[model samples]
Target: MERVYIGMGSNLAAPAEQLREALKALGQLPHTRLSGVSSFYVSDSLLPGQPRYTNAVAALDTALEPLALLDALQAIENGQGRERLERWGPRTLDLDILLFGDRLIDEPRLKVPHYHMQARAFVLYPLAELAPGITLADGRALDGLLAACPFEGLERL
Candidate 1:
C-alpha cells in the first residue's frame, strides 16, 4: 500500500458535517484504508468573496497509484455535491491530493505534494497535526512548513 495524504475542506452547507462525511466517503474507496486524520480546522476565506472554510487532512494507505487516487478523490467530491463554479471558489466539498507516497508529479491534471499546499495554513496546520514530524520526498518537514506558513486564519476545530 502506498501512503497518501489528502486535504479536505468545505465552506458551504454545514461545513463541519460535510467534512466529516467526506472523510467517511473517502475511506470507503476500494483498496484503501484510512490510517489517520487531523482535527477539523476553520480558516477565513482565501478568496475575496468566499465563505470561511472548515478543513482537515487525512492519511490513507492505498493500492491505487497517483492518477487513480486522484480519480477516486474527484468522485468523492462529486458525491458530496461539489461543483467547479470557479477557480478556488466555494464548494460543499473540496478534496486535494497532498502527497502520494514520496513521489513528485508534475502534470496539468495533478501535482503531487500539492503545488501550493505548503503555503496555505488551512492545509499545512492540519497536515502537521496528523503527521507532525513527517518529511516529504523533498526533505521538508511538515512541522517546519507549518511554522513558516504565514496564513493566520488556521484554528483547530
Candidate 2:
C-alpha cells in the first residue's frame, strides 16, 4: 500500500461534519484505509468574498494508483454535494490529493506532492498535523516544510 495524504476543506453548510463524512467515505473506498486525521481548523479563504473554511488532512494507505486515488477523492466530494462553479469557489467539500507515496507526478490534470503544497498554509498546517513525519517525493520532511511557512490565518476548530 502507498501512503498518501488528502487535504480537505469546506466553507458551506456544517463544514466540520462534511469533512468528517468525507473522510469516512474515503476510508470506505476499496483498497484504501484511513490511517490518520487531523483536527478541524478554520482558515480565512484565499479567494476574496469567499466564506471561511474548515480544513483538515487525512492520511491513508491505499493500493490505488495516484490518478485512481484522485478520482476517488473527487467522487467523495461529489457525494457530499459539492458543486464547482468557479475557481476556489465555496463548496460543500473540497478534497485535494496532497501527496501520493514518494512519487512526483506532474501532468495537465494532476500534480503529486501538489504543485502548490508548500505555499498554502491551509493545506500544509493540517497535513503536517496529520502526518508530521512524512517525507515528500523531493525528500523534504513535511515538518521541515511547515517550519518555514509564514501563513497566519489558521486556527484549530
Best by lDDT: 1
Residues 44-150 of candidate 1: C-alpha lDDT, one tens digit per residue: 88788888899998999999988888898898889889999888889999899998889988888998879888789889878877777989987788878877886
Q: Residue 29 in model 1: shift from native, Å? A: 0.4
What TM-score, over all chains together, does every model reach? 0.94, 0.93
lDDT of 2 by residue, 1-157 (tens): 9888888999999999999899889879999999999888898888888889999889999999888888888888888899989877899999888888888989777888887788888888888777768788888887888888865888887
Model 1, global lDDT: 0.88
lDDT (Cα atoms) of all candidates against the true structure? 0.88, 0.87
Looking at model 2, report the run of 10 residues with the lowest lDDT sum: 125-134
Instruction: List candidate 2 stretches off by more than 4 Å.
Output: none
